[model samples]
Target chain A: MDDLPSLPAKLARLRHAHPGDFNLSRIDPAAQPCSRGGKAADKVRVEELAVELDGLQNRFWADRRHRLLVVLQGSDTSGKDGTVRGVFGRMSPLGVHVVSWKAPLGPERERDFLWRIHAQMPGNGEITVFNRSHYEDVLVPVVEGDLRGKALQRRYRQINDFEQMLTETGTVIVKFMLHISREEQRVRLQERLDDPEKAWKFDPKDLEVREHWDDYQRAYRDAISATGTRWAPWHVVPADSKTHRNLMVATVLKATLQSLDLRFPPLPKGLAGVRVK
Target chain B: MDDLPSLPAKLARLRHAHPGDFNLSRIDPAAQPCSRGGKAADKVRVEELAVELDGLQNRFWADRRHRLLVVLQGSDTSGKDGTVRGVFGRMSPLGVHVVSWKAPLGPERERDFLWRIHAQMPGNGEITVFNRSHYEDVLVPVVEGDLRGKALQRRYRQINDFEQMLTETGTVIVKFMLHISREEQRVRLQERLDDPEKAWKFDPKDLEVREHWDDYQRAYRDAISATGTRWAPWHVVPADSKTHRNLMVATVLKATLQSLDLRFPPLPKGLAGVRVK
Candidate 1:
């Protein structure tokens, strides 16, 4: 990450590499379907990582000056919610703000796309998370032909400038595109169909998008290549294994926050007289 | 409380009567510095009220529509932070937001007082707790002479209308004024000086305000009486005893949210498929 001058070249090399493509069978998981791993090594590492993240969360809370923004985007069943809950489970509630941007509300729809995004920015010393963000203006509209031809291309330029402005204004944007294979997605889709509680999460339209998988992939690749920059690099996370994906994300966050050099400010002198008990 | 018409008369009567001066030494605390308590019948009733409030928090989370706004205002030893921590400890992080307003930043100081307050308003179904809010425009500035002469009266009018607007837009505002005695304040201030960690919380300037305690009380009484409405009533809680204060604040919150008649909305039928394994 320190090699900021050559970040574009590095990202291009990553974008060009062959991606992971492993799809396993669909299994009907019981009440305890959420698992880390049975292996001792995995358990120990996850525990250590959890503790480290807790410390990081405390530092972020205590410093209360530097801010972080994490942008998560992925295909259906890519585990955006799961990733957040797993990684930030131990974080202090005060230090983190999670905003799940749904279909725009009345006032939001009337404004330019970035209007709502800008409104959700965290104040100093906090973290703001975007479940899916302004990137959708480019990705969804492009692949779905919701904004076709000239309109679709225009969105790309607007999004790039929007992200760049956010970066310049002390917002550290970490965008993650969770990459899962078609077969793996199919399994998840089936699991959703089978579980009554999860039935609400499924959409017939989602299957239609699955049909245009290659088209969406191309759109994603183009979007990443066109917009990723030194200020905000898109990390194309391998999502076939949930554990591995969480680890990679945690590591990136740790490195980035550490680089920022956050520290607790010195307490003001002689405040003992303020306590009530 | 359901009999609002009669309750207003009762509140009027309570306002006219002089409250017995607060004595901190008599009431026993059951947490933190030491845990001891008497099973007072009134305390038991308040504790039950708090438990009911927890249920309301769950309902707010489920409904995602009835947002609760709690405004805590008082002199220094009012237990605003403690009330938030104790009462909302079990509430879902997803549905709650706490804002502690201190001195305004340069940009904030340039704007009208309500500017920063409006920015922190919670979305639908979210509960936002403000520790010292827009009322400070009148309370602090009026006492401090920061806004001299005619300017002071304008702020009170503006704050009243701003709060009315929030109520009109479905935001329930419950304001509280914590009342403590001079002798009790002296004991708490002394305790803070005796403790190492609490020493940093004291300010010599706090004593400047303490000197004009009667002036502040008069300002508070006028502000509350002028602005308090049926839609958003102000509750004056005796807060010399930390346990009694925490319980009273919790009781007020419980009553306010429960009055909203919050209920969970049905899940979108389409997302019913997912089950946690």
Candidate 2:
């Protein structure tokens, strides 16, 4: 944040999707909207953001005044896992947990969708990441035609209100939608199938989902338009390049944590001679 | 680990304290036993080690084959907190936890000493760092003469047995004794008292402990010699210089994890086209 200090306004206005008339087509997934210079300069800038983030998290952990929820939602091969390892690898397990959500299982499917999601939310002085999240309930259901019209609108409203309440209670929410081009997805999917080590990540279900690529993209755009609230605006990260995807998310996270101006808490009573006087 | 690969054997041999004749005096707190070159080169090497460490941790978390316990034991001003920030700052909160142990209280005191220590050991696929550890039980009691002779010897044996059991169950243990000179400690303690921001760290009890410097050193020497074993040897870090202390610990941790040679576990059956053999 200290080094990438100049991009705050540009970052928000460029990548943040606005409500109602948000146009996903205007943004290019391959473009480096937040890149400082060439790839080399951008890579170095990301490292700076990572170091600054580590420093801020130290204070945030000590501050104990705020909780953090980071949602990473994207296509199957759009680099959510990479973002976790590259962007958040430096933070300690003392305060952060990464929750990779899959399809709803027996009991999770039996309850209201947010029940399991709510259970995983970060507590005070902690960070909980959803590698995928309730955002999926909106996406998959809408794409499959199971949820639409009044029901679809209701789901989006539920997410917006839930996020607002969390913010009201001192949790900072940051949502990211990793937008990768259709061509990039094809290449990534092929790579997963071709590389034996990566073959394990290649789900036949992903192939079935990829067949409805355009439908999924349309679903994502609608969800962003409906749910991009003031409390938790969605940062649509360009995800064709893994480094830029990580760089943008790291920059935004640092900026958000920095905005709080976290500080060390006051010393405990009778220690350091700090008394009420 | 790969870049600093040349120094592994020498690293273990030079700093590792032997069981009975673990003479703490011969080791100079200011000496650079593990310095690659000068300060600049050592700083760069530490960064490389950190990056490599990040990569290994990713595999370790996925491997889920072993747990890791790192014990950082030292005097009041020997840079334990700084080491946590500098050496392990790059790790994610998903896999690594830094626990600062204070004097055990209430129920912790009600039970035997190892009770709380055992409760905090790392689970599978996790790493837990003890900013201070159960070793304090050995040091404080013996220094105050509340425990001595055969009683103290029994406590040491109990600790050794507990650690050995943990190793037998698949936890890799690395113990570091951050050895700083008495004069270095005096300066640090004075700085803590003088700097208002750092004043909170100055404990009044620490001053009382510093007065018995020689007795504490004797106690430390005894503890290290007694508890140092095949499963967990004490790495006596020359920690007057903060950079070297972090550098040495990072190198040792990298090497230790490297020896494990973690790999990705086999993918789940019926997924990735892997069926019965």
Candidate 3:
């Protein structure tokens, strides 16, 4: 009943167990998980998964019982927005919503950290994609030395509590920690600067955050370890290869959706065989 | 040099020592701790404190190092709006800002309970008054039975952590639990209905919460108990008399600002005695 090896095995390897067990540095970003063979095949698989996802999403929308939240968290230029487009582009926009988080500004910054993120949660049967998320609260603050020790631990606990509540209340959360190497990031960031089409995405402020690359990696590992739960588990996505990143994410989404046993909801009472008015 | 009796003693009595030490049911709503004889004199003193507050606010604006956050929490018609007017009416609006927290709606409800409140915090050299505040998250949900036991405890902890951060980052927080009786609330609710001018302020939803009066009282007690920390202590202000409420709040503001010993930044480097050309 389950074709688990290629998909679950990779995710299982990537799935962080606890704060003490996970190490971020050893995982190679270039290593393709759930790959078919090469980049061309991986791209083809992404398209297939996108179509299956579309079908599953339609059922998901009709089922209207569960909510799906795909959280894509990574450093800048690790392709969050691109992942959204590649993995979810074919799905109908009506049920699929994407929110790209940024630095909390005037209104967002004034309150407790999680307000903005919570306000953007997907309603029942809808799939919401977070380009970056509340995880950034833990990361940026940790690396910049703004939040340390107990404060950081508290945030992790807060997130776990929040996700547990979400799961208990019907939100099926699948978090992806897109793993990319420092070298790969440098190349991608350079592309952002070099390509005029991509130059607009580059922030000089990002370079400052990038300067804390190793720190962010450590932050990410710590965050993943502390926050990953049985309910909302973290899956590390090797994202150096665009094809592999999209493919792995799309495949995971398919597996997640399929596991739900979603179906088009039955007709309402007294309308089972009724046609249009 | 300190006139301690008429101020600090009252606050000391009202100040909750810890969650276990405070009992809401034992406190009288009609008790006036800081009243100077009668309503007429108290009203006049409110005007005087308003004047003093305006002067202190100017110094506070110039000081630019410390921020003030005054949190007002109470049942409906506990005189939050009236206190804001009577106490802050004379202060220069440039330095004093008021945020009236409402029930979290569309954008606000989606995030964690604290986001909206956090976004509304005062910047340095400013006094921000919260007419209603983050305390509502703990109170309302508890009264409505949406949160219980450990979940409730976690929220209180989250609040303490939040307020701790605010205080550590230069914000001085004064939280007031405006204590009003069930009878006072009935009279007030009746006024809203009887007075057409006040009818618009009435929400039908409020009546439902009002019905849960005892539950809410218990919730408030629990909230004040758990959240009242050394950094941000809770002061229970008996709010039956609007004049006393305003007078007490105004006097507290005066005391808080005076203790800061704010002085204008010494005429910026070379401009100590320079005249405008």
Candidate 4:
């Protein structure tokens, strides 16, 4: 009855209707590899989406009041950086803004994780992306002895309420938890080490956490299950392949922006040419 | 005699050398018919520069301390916005930041014009571009009657000093005044009026200013000649063709960035893969 479709059912229908579109080659949490059939079609769609996104971004610049925020959360090597470049690459310069959350600033470190994030929220008619977001506070700190017990519980509550408020204030939060198998991450990390161009990406710090990969998985499951909601829902994306990752993300992004029914604002009439003679 | 080449000659050499490296066809600032050049070498060179620019932009992101400032000033339909998108599109989302100055904000209008521009100056390791800049205080207001006599002279002095300060603090200012013949502008204005898609771009107010084109040109020449310095200089780009324009601008941008000699910061050793066991 609502104007919006039930997101869960919509996702389920999409998965069923476009079974070939799903990237099965990506192993799930269990480390068992799955394979899919429509890689070529998926790639073409992504290119199309990139161009459409350019138009949408330009429209956002022209319209000036609608702002979009994309949140990417996932295991290491889930293609967050690449997706950002691929999906939003065609956007015009002034229309989009991307903030990748790393170590917080001095003031940010003192306050809650969400405080710094809130500060970077997009103004009207812009798009802001969080490469790794507030979820890191819950995921990283909880897994690594940075925060524990009641502090963790309080954070989850704060995150839910914070997102709800953001949604109420015209922010559309599309959260993606990039799901990948331990085996895939191992292979990916090895590739980073082997490829000279990618060597800069190889951080030995990733392996220490790789040992406790199961703990991180459990944390992600809990965080996603708890925070997934009507206004700001979480999408569990299988991201073993970069192409699949870009397509899934673009499909969701296009659907979300299109739902807004963006159109060019009417220009003032008689603006053609003024007679100065 | 310095490591830097002769500024004026170096820029002119670069522009002439990269005839095929920029796309100047799309930016027809005149009311004439479109023309095509059949130089395969030029087409190939333009493509090469596009790729090179991608690499340069990545290095810019990795370097982080070298900020880029592209200042675009031009007549109506001079293609400033298009140049920005075409030239800087491939840069990392993190490194490039664009600030388009408009009729002053309430707070901005009260303070000196240079004040608003200064606040938007790029932080260390970022790129800040001004679509139109503080020159407007001296250029537009003088042409429009909003500024005159003692006030105009005072503002001009304030701007030159302000820019010197920005250069002193490590801002690399590359100013471009897009130069199109009056006949070219007439063609562009008519194009906007003729094409429905571009109908929104035609503003009658622009024509009122067109009447005083020579006055504005004289003002531009005086201001640029006065303010051009070793730290920051204005490049007057001929803008009759978009291909020539894009190539010329990209070459200038490349020459400026290459001169910076950016290299990736050394990564901390031992930060790579830690044993998870």
Candidate number of the best DockQ: 4
Candidate 2 structure quality by residue, lDDT tens digits, B79-104:
88888767776766567766778898
Models ranked on lDDT: 2, 3, 4, 1
Task: Give stretches of model 2 more than 4 Å off.
Answer: A1-28, A58-67, A89-130, A133-166, A196-228, A263-277, B1-26, B59-64, B90-95, B102-126, B134-162, B193-219, B264-277
Better of 1 and 3 by DockQ: 1
For each candidate, the DockQ is: 0.17, 0.17, 0.01, 0.31
lDDT of 4 by residue, B158-230 (tens): 7667867877777787888787888878888877776665666667778788889988877776566566655
**Model 3 Cα lDDT, one tens digit per residue, A127-211:** 8888788999999888889998887888889998998899899999999988888888888777665554454455666667777
For model 1 the local lDDT of residue A77 reads 88
Chain A TM-score vs. truth, each candidate: 0.81, 0.93, 0.94, 0.85
Which of the two candidates, 1 or 2, achieves a greater lDDT against the reference?
2
Question: How large a fraction of the reference contact set does each model reproduce?
Answer: 0.15, 0.21, 0.00, 0.25
Of the candidates numbered 3 and 4, which has the greater TM-score value? 4
Fold similarity of candidate 3's chain A to the true chain A, as a TM-score: 0.94
- What's every prediction's RMSD, in angstroms? 7.8, 6.0, 19.4, 6.2
lDDT of 1 by residue, B197-234 (tens): 44444566777778877678767776776666656667
What DockQ does candidate 2 have relative to the true complex? 0.17
- TM-score of model 3 relative to the true fold? 0.50
Candidate achieving higher DockQ, 2 or 3? 2
**Per-residue C-alpha lDDT of model 2 across residues A161-198, encoded as one tens digit per residue:** 89889989999888899989988988888776556556
Candidate 2 pairs with clashing backbones = A90-B90, A91-B93, A92-B93, A93-B93
